[model samples]
Target chain A: MISLKRTMLFIPGNNPSMLMNSIVFGSDCVIFDLEDAVSEKQKDAARILVRNGLKTLDFENTEVFVRINDISTKYWKNDLEEVMKGKINSILLPKTESPKSVKEAEKYIEELEKKYNIEKQITIMPLLETALGIENAFQIAKSSERIEGLFLGAEDLTADLGAKRTKEGKEILYSRSRVVTAAKAAKILAIDTPFTDVDDDEGLVKDTIFAKEIGFDGKASISPRHVDIINKIFMPSKEEIIYAHKVIDAIEKAEEEGKGVVSLEGKMIDAPIVNRARKVLLVLNKSRGVM
Target chain B: MKIKNIAIVGSLESNDVMITIEPLENKLEIIIESIVYDQFNEEIKKAVQDVCDELEVKQAKIKVNDRGALECTIKARMEAAIIRGKGEIL
Candidate 1:
C-alpha cells in the first residue's frame, strides 16, 4: 500500500527538542532539514544529532525524510554518509536543477546503501527550487528509479526569478502547473511548496485547497499548526467518497449486466472518471490506516 | 582521543543537554547537572561514559548541563563535543 503524504513537516536537524518530539505533530511525513535549517558552523553537530535521533527514536508509522544539502555543496556527501547509517524513508535533494543531479545523488545513495548493508533501497525526492529545475522538471522526475516525488521550493525559486513572494502566490502559478504536469507525466507525487506565513491560517487553507485542485499530492509545512489544515484539505471528503462508492457500484452492476459502458446518474463513466474514483477510495483507505 | 581544547555543543533548551569538554591531565571527569537529576542521574552519567568509551577518550573534563534530554541526545552531544575537543573537524 502506498503512503499518503498530505503534510510533511520540517524539523531543524540541529534542534534536539524538535527532533525528539517530531512524531507528535500528526504529520503524514516529517522532514529533518539539514540544509537551510542548520548553520554551516553547526553542520557536523546537526548531522550527528539527527543521525542519533533517527537511530534511537521510534517513528513507528510516520514516513521519515532528511533534507540534505545540495549536490553541488561539500556537505551533501557527508550528510548522506551519516544519515544513511540510520533509519530514513527518503532523501530530499534541495536545489536540484537537472537529471544529472538526481543521477549523481542516486549513485552515491546506492553506494551508501551497499556500505551500510541496507537491503531496502532508499528513495529520493528532488526539490525544484530554481528556474532551471522547474524547466527540466520532467526529465529530473524520470531521472532515477528512486525518485519518489517532485517538491517545489517556491521561496528560493521566486528569489531566483527575482519575483516578490506573496501570500496570493500569483507569481508561481506557471511553475506550480509545470511541476504538477511533470510529476503526473512521470507517475510520481507532486508536493507543493509550503505557505510561509505561519500565523495566517486562512491563507494556508486557501493555498492548500488550490494545490489539491491543481493536482498536488501534498504540501510541505514549516509549522505544526499547518499539518492538520493540509491533511484535512487533502483528505477525501464525505461526498466525494460516497460518489466514488456509487461509481464503483454502478460499474460493477454494468459488468454484471454485460453492458459495454457504465453510467452513473445519467453521466457516462469513462476510464478517467473511474480511475479518479478509484484514487479517491485509495486515498480514503490510506487515511483510514488500511494500508 | 585526547581533549586538546575546550569545546562545547548543544544548548540549554528544553529536552536538550549542553556538553562542554576540556583537556584534563590524566583522569576522566564528568559533572552532570540535569533537571531530572534525582531520577536519571546515573542514566545520564552512563550515557556520557558510554560515549567517552566509544570515542576512546583517555582524559577529559566533561560538564553536562542537561535540560531533561534523552539518553540518545546526551550521547550525541557528548560525542560531538569530544570530537571537537580533539581539534578535529567532523
Candidate 2:
C-alpha cells in the first residue's frame, strides 16, 4: 500500500480528544507526538495514553506514526517500551545526526518487536533537523532497510544553522534540497516541515507549491485546517490525471505497434515522461484508496 | 501499599475520563457517572476492577466520570489515581 503522505498531522500524545479524533481530520498520516509536544511530567501518562489509543481507537484510512524522544534522551527507551506495545505504522526519530543513529534505532526497534512479540516490522522515518543530519542524509536514508522516508525539520535545522527563521524560507533552501535529493536517491519519500503560519491559507498554498517544485513528496501540518489544502496541492489535479491516462494509453498502443518512441498530444514522450505519468496515476489511485 | 488521600487524574474531554481514588478501610466502593453509563456501565466497572485486581488493591473508593473513554484509558486513569493516592510515581 503506497501510503500517501500528503499531510501528516501531529497530535499531542496526552491530548486524548485529539488522539481519538485524529483520523476524522482527513490527514493521510497522524503522528502521535511523544517527544517535543509532551512535557516531562506527563511523559508516562502520555505514553500510556498513546498506547491505549493505538490499541483501542480505530484510525481507519489514516496511517499512524509515533514520534518518540531522541536517542540522546533517557525517555526514548521508555517511550519505545510503551509505543512498541501498540500496533503502529512507523516511528519518527528526531535529531537523527548520523547513519549510525538510524542503525541504532533499527536495532532498538527490532529488540522491541521481539520483546512485545509484534509480528510485523515498523518502518522508521528519520527527521533531519541538524546541519550534520543534512550533510549525512543520504547515508542515513540508506542506513536501514526499515527507513521508508526522510523528513526535513526546518525549525530545528534553522536553529542548528544559527540563522533567523523567515517566512521566505530561503535560509534552509540548501538543506531542504539536500534532504529531497537524499530521499530521491534512496527511493523514499521526502516530507517537508510544517508551515508555521496557520492562518495564511495563500501562504500555505504558495509554500506547498514551492515544496512540490523542489521534489518533496509531501509536507507536515500542525493544524487540521491545513490538511485539505495540503492534500489538494500535493495530489494530482484532474487535468493531470486525464493526461496521465492518455500518456499510459499512448504508451500501451505504441508497445503494441512495436514502436520505441511515443508521442502524446503531438509532443514526443520518452521513458522518463512515461515513468512520471505512471507515478502520477499511482499516486492518484492511492489518493482515491484504489491501491 | 495503602492509598492515603484522594487523588485525581485524567480529564473530562470527549474521549477521556476523570477518575478520583480515595483510601478506604474495609470494602471496595466504586461510583461511576457517565454519559453512556447505561450502555457501558458494566464495562467501565470491569475496567476499574481489572486495575485494582492487578495492583492487588483491597480497599478504596473509586469515582469515575467518563466521557466515552475506552477500557484501556479507564484502567490507566484508575491506576494513575491509585498510584498518586499512594504518594508514589511510576
Error at B87, model 1, angstroms: 1.9
Model 1, A239-260: lDDT tens per residue?
A: 9999999999999999999998
How do the residues A1-291 of candidate 2 rate in per-residue lDDT, one tens digit apiece? 346788899999888779878888888899999988988877777888898788888887788999999999888888888878887989999999998998888888899898888988899999999999999999999999889899999998899999988888999899989999999999889999999898999999999999999999889999999999998888887888899899999999999999998998899998767876887887787667785
| List of clashing residue pairs for candidate 2 | none
For model 1, name the residue pairs that clash. none
Residue A162 lDDT in model 1? 98
- Give me the displacement of residue A79 in model 1, in angstroms: 0.8
Off by over 4 Å in 1: A243-279, A285-291
DockQ metric for all predictions: 0.80, 0.52
- TM-score for each candidate, following the candidate numbering: 0.92, 0.87
Looking at model 2 chain A, which ten-residue stretch has the lowest summed lDDT? A282-291
Candidate 1 lDDT at A63 equals 93
State how far residue A93 of model 1 sits from its true place (Å).
0.2
Question: Residue A221 in model 1: shift from native, Å?
Answer: 0.3
